[model samples]
Target: MRRITVPIALLALLGSAVPAAAAQAAPPPSIAWTACDPAEEVPEGVLCATLEVPVDWSRPGGPTIELALAKRPATDPSRRIGSLLINPGGPGGSGVDFAYFSGSAFSPAVTDRFDIVGFDPRGQARSHVVNCDSDLIGAQYTQLYPDNRAEYADLRATNRALALSCRELSGPLVTYVDTASVARDMDAIRAGLGEKRISYYGVSYGTMIGQQYAELFPSRIRALALDSNMDHAQNIAGYQKWESLAMEGSFRQFTSWCDRTEACALHERGALAYFDELYARAEAGELNPDGQPLPPEDLVNIVFGYMYNPNSWFELADTLLYLGQGDGGQTGRGEPVPNGYLPVMCSDFHFDVGAYPVLRAIEQAQNRLAPHTRLNPLAWSDLASCQNWPWKVTNPPHRLRASAELPPILLANSRWDVATPYEWGTSLASQLPSARFLTYDGVGHGTYWRSDCARAAIDTYLVELRTPAKGTHCPAVFPSSPVSAQAVPTVVDPLPQLTGPFRR
Candidate 1:
């Protein structure tokens, strides 16, 4: 692995200007719809298209990248209101895949009234993806949690190497994958589709894009629905605190469920104590149900992934029970490879832990905030991975500047979302005075698919332009047992399919 060093002068150039393509007076060229490639696996009626957007929005005539798009035409074209753009929320999530596979997730009323459109944001799937060396990414020294100064240096070195590889393989687009750029691409999409305004459904990280778009093009939004929101106003400490707090809260909810639910495999053994024992075994390098040892970080990541949905609690309980009983049959699950989306995260938020001392302090605070979970795997990963990322912070965290003329945007989040957290939604609602917040008293990353009440509220808001009543709350729904939980089809829940650093 070769260590690549970038000059401080180049870093300054990268961060010099925030792209403002949405403010450009010139209109984008219209898209020409065509059939999707057979490999895309789109449904029968779905149409595919590509729109040309500047790799560096500030230099519109310099270089352009193609943004992939998918659209499911309205079921009833006669009553079509407009296009409803949907994004499934990884900083790397494939909106095109969401449009093809999860179109059924929306209500018939919504489907009948609007064309469901999804675009793979720049440097994401179908679009020009950020590429990096896999071996460097998977290197043992690339661990996110560094204990000492030497290990911290190795982590930073590895991150810089990965960034260099991405730049080398991906070209200039890698330096411009910020959410603000994506938001500008969205406005371009709206223009290309020839619609005066477009309705939007953005979840998790996608909410950040939607929020920025609203700030840039407030008058051009027909309706906006932000689910599992990202609070773009947090500093380093605030970001870690809220994320770790949410992860810890979800773990507690799982333990509480195990205590009362007779169907939970770990109910008799005690969920928390059993999990703690597993953690101890992992740390001791003895927790090997299959032949390979499970590292403590991997153990925590497994738990973190399961916490994304309440329906997966039973599966999580069973997995832990199997591990406790030394059942190799349930082990040996392979982790997803890195998709090189860190630049998007690195650019959108500032997570610079200047030195190991600052990093140690942040870890201490997180541990105190989330003793059982220790730290949020995703949140900590973002903070640690961006320590020495070569890309400049193009769209750093700041107060949201939503327009007063903006319509009432609908916001929804689960009370126990391990990924996005409930307070993020409320925090955003406070920032956008016209926005209405909807709370689902549940455990999950997203509210729309998990709760019918939430879905109804969102659909009504999107289709009828009527916001949910102030202080509206949706009841949580839980499956009876592990077997019954498996009955919930995977297609209905589209977010978990997204694979990357920020799986939200």
Candidate 2:
């Protein structure tokens, strides 16, 4: 879990600032592309550019902020259909880095037909960034379980202080980094590319951006494919509960695999019991002091992080074995890799945690129902810190409806996605008047990177404008045996393909 800030009185200024410049006829925004700097990671023919967008859409001409953009042009420009704008869904994930890293992964057909483009959302890396106290963040880390009322109170206070620190450091842009704003930014990118209608590929929180863009400018979308969908319809408590349940399910799957597979080092010792012992030891703070000892929360985080993709299961198993043997010093399991989770998430949903007692009740209930996911407390409590957040939430949770004239948007989700639950994909599909849902009967979060079925569907939909039939299901594919030529190995598979190349 990552830490975030919740500024106080943030909403009071909404619409209170100088009213947005009145609607007026104006020239479309244009991007001036330039050759990217020499770098090993950047592919040939990829161009980078920076465009300015208003901090407030209402005032499109005022207080401009620079947006970083990058593009990998179609291999066959003559055959190009249009620009394919992508958002990798950190709300903080860098679209620019994603395009450079994963450009080659797309099938040749896609590369030939589309100019792949990516941009860093406002207040994200490579764009205008949100700064805070790195030391404070490093020290506090994420608090997975609040053992008592005082601990919960301390957590809240720490959150409040952090929010203030971030606001002071991040400035006004932090208050404006909502999905609605990013959706508008997408439209600008579409215009800058000189495309009448842009195709889209959004995953995770990126799905929310796609949904909002559909609602706001449905006519501008040529084709949309949202993977690992996010249902922005739920409020704070509901959102927390949904995530908790999903993580609990993934936890069970992980332990079950460990129990049945001889490949798992702890199998003979009873994987479930081993896990229980690890948790108990963590809680007791009895692990060795070889380096930086991991608390119970971080041990859970390490396990939970690897649960996103089973390809990493072997590595996860190895990591657990080392920790269990008291061999830990500094572990990557709990290291903080910030992707601007705070500004966007806090601006989108308000977590309504009242007094300390209220938080206590919520934590107790979640623990009772999902003990394995005591991790939810930290993930959820971070939201409540927004109560006094200085910036107002510009876009609260709401049902999104795509225009009837829009093409049927494609949705892909795995059956056991802990980060963005499969249920969310299904729920989002139902809400959209025009949608085609493809279910991957596999583990992990995003599907296109790992499942052949998913890739085929996405390719057909994006390139041919053909939607898969409703209720389409893709079967799970396990790692192949050593002697079996039929198996596709993804042991080091990254959870979401686009961000994989950049992962530390």
Candidate 3:
């Protein structure tokens, strides 16, 4: 999933085309941008605009699509150094939101250097948004039924209907939302900005977009920073991690944080004991924090939901703790799992479980690997969506290494990031010749390289095109990520892990 924006003044990207790669992989695609409302200006230094593109690049001219876009101008136009486009991680992340939320952070020095930009890619967020209607809503990525497998068969049928719905609603657009096409869109923005080369900073899936763009338009890069790395070469199949492991990963990180605290509910002699007891209570169908029957599996989904952003870590711990607390602590709500987390998490990735059987099969495989960790919502998400998706499941290639010719790329990962494991980023970095690795031994995703030294290194790179030493570990807490000349974000104190599930 991709949030397609960064804060910058303005520029162009196509809205509605599908990738020519799907039709013919020979030559890469190009983009043509439609006029967004450029004459109109938003409050302050921002502007609102749109890029009209084809839904499917394969049939580029057949149908048109629109991408919602925004830009935050450089504070000093006199010293502006083209545009610095930003894309957040989620395939479903909102770039416009990222700019709105973090665009200011890059201000003063960074904003003076480049205009920050953000946009929602087609089929997600404000672009060509996708909706599965009500019936498909609750079924979401669930195993289906009232926790019944047989009922899941029916849910599978419903999921197939979702594909049909997408086909009908999205038409030519659904197929073109791949990274390669987005890369082409990047080129369009570069052209619109009137810059021969484009500078960019992408996180998570955005990193993959940056990867594809660099691969296709090597000469077009001025300066680039890729925060979290993704193995786009892996395709749709290896995406199995979307399942329970997603949640399990978060659980491990969250529980480890709790292990250091004595009062933490699940903080038995350690996190493991607390977790064991907590699960036993959920398994026994005891009263959950909300007073509803703890489905036992809801914890997985909740934890899985929490792992995506560092901002949620504290809430995640408290939420989990509250869930396992029964009616004694909080209000007597009905269920343990908060109802809100599902829509946000499920919407982040379009698993389209209707067509992929391989993901479903992976469920049994997961149990074999980590039986105790299996059945959690994250794992279940990996499996359930595949079971019901409309497409066939096949192998997606893995990128043990990336093409060596890209610009200086930065790989950042936190040791305890539940959403993305640290090793994966390092392994991906190991694959690229022009990349460097920074490990944050602290908590949270993308924070591994969040320190000022790391920031200064990155900031200096963007402004002067430099790279940090090949392998460096930022032991002290770092800033969220890097920017031009960043010293590092200093917190008053190390945030403690919020209390969570109390094991026996």
Candidate 4:
């Protein structure tokens, strides 16, 4: 997961509209591939290219932007099917990085048959990035949990300032980074590759992109594998209740693991109770050994970040134990503000927080629903960050209208996913005309990475156009031995580190 610093500033800057370039008839794009940049350290066989597309699809002959693309060619070209476009779900996540670094995460069955192509969606990563003043972005973090109307108003002003800064610095592209635009960009990529149809593998936020693509161009997709699905039909209330419930469920899973596993640092001491004590200390302004104050939100974020993967539960236990003993360590510091998170989210979903009373009521409801974790930090952050966003909701929440002719889409989700809830996968499945939902009875955000059964199902669907039977469920898989301090698994997925809530 990419971690970016968001610093808040009070400067005001006026944004200018993008100037239209020379008018030309819209034509199918083509790529001129070259060797991967040495600095990127992409695997030996990967090639890189860029596709130039219009900033606004409505004005096909308008200002243009270049999207970064990376491809790992199929190892066995004799059996190669086609390009399998992959996305690792940070609205801000780098597809180029995922393709470069985590291509090995795919099963050999997939790797041997399809070229793994990853692209940084418009305004993400190597694409024309959306940037704002760091100080302006950082200021909003302090108001994530406002106490009164005055604080809430301050939060709104800060959010407005951040949006204005992004507009001024990033230009018109800031207004067009919604998932719908990215979905259109995906088709442009397909056209550039000269492919009649493209298969897709999207996780977390990427699932939203995949869904929008399938909706807009159903006939253009050969297959789609969406893991840890996003429900585009949710309103603000649905986001709050379901996201918080999912986090709470994951927290319960962790506590249950501690109860049965002797290797858990807090097994002897009650894990939930110890976490409560830490939260109390944080709220009371207790300083860690390093003398930095651990705010309650920071403490919650630390735990939420670790909850993405079961293997990281051991690290989380150790970190909490250290914090309890007055050792601040690395995890004590709060996550940096999420840059480029608000624009896409605010543009895509309408968050009608309304007046402070309404916001306060929402907070109270979240607290009641999730007393243990307080709330999903990512969910609350998304709500708070979009308070005074300058952009309009270009793609607001609604039930998906997928084409009946669309190929069968494969959806997977863990039973206890902390980010995208399992209900979202099922909900999305119901929305699509032809979709099969695969349940991973496990405890992680991305089911494909955690369950071999999920990976096999997805691979078969992508390579052979075979869907798993309806209501397919993969049994949970846990480490044979309890996780010890020295045995904590390395987290390869970057979604957890990204600040946005839906990042898988």
- Tens-digit lDDT track for model 4 on 311-423? 77877888888888875422222332336667899998988577999999998999899998878988888898899787789988899998887988899999988789888
What do the candidate models score in CA lDDT, each in turn?
A: 0.83, 0.71, 0.55, 0.80
Query: Best lDDT goes to which candidate?
Result: 1
Q: Candidate 4's error at 132, in angstroms?
A: 0.9
**What is candidate 2's CA lDDT for residue 209?**
86
What's the TM-score of every candidate structure?
0.91, 0.87, 0.73, 0.89
Residue 12 local lDDT, model 3: 18
Order by TM-score, highest first: 1, 4, 2, 3
Pairing residues by index, what is the TM-score of model 1?
A: 0.91
RMSD of each: 6.4, 6.6, 9.0, 7.7
Q: Which candidate is the best by TM-score?
A: 1
TM-score winner between candidates 1 and 4 = 1
Better structure of 2 and 4 per lDDT: 4
In TM-score terms, candidate 4 sits at 0.89
Candidate ranking under lDDT, highest first, comes to 1, 4, 2, 3
Residue-level lDDT of model 1, residues 1-504, one tens digit each, is: 212322222222223242454224344356788899987567899999987766876765557778899989999999999999999888889999888865677778788988899999898888987777676667523478889999999999888977787777777777798999998889878877888778999999889999999987898899999999999898888888989999889899999899899999888989999899998998898888887788877888889988877788888998888776672422332233435468898998999878899999999999898888888888888898888888779998987897887988999999998889888888999999989999999898778888889999998999899998999999987777878787855338777676443488
Model 3 lDDT tens row, 61-118 = 4466667777777777888787788877556666665554444344255667777887
lDDT of 3: 0.55
For model 4, the local distance difference test gives 0.80
Q: What value of lDDT does candidate 1 attain over all alpha carbons?
A: 0.83
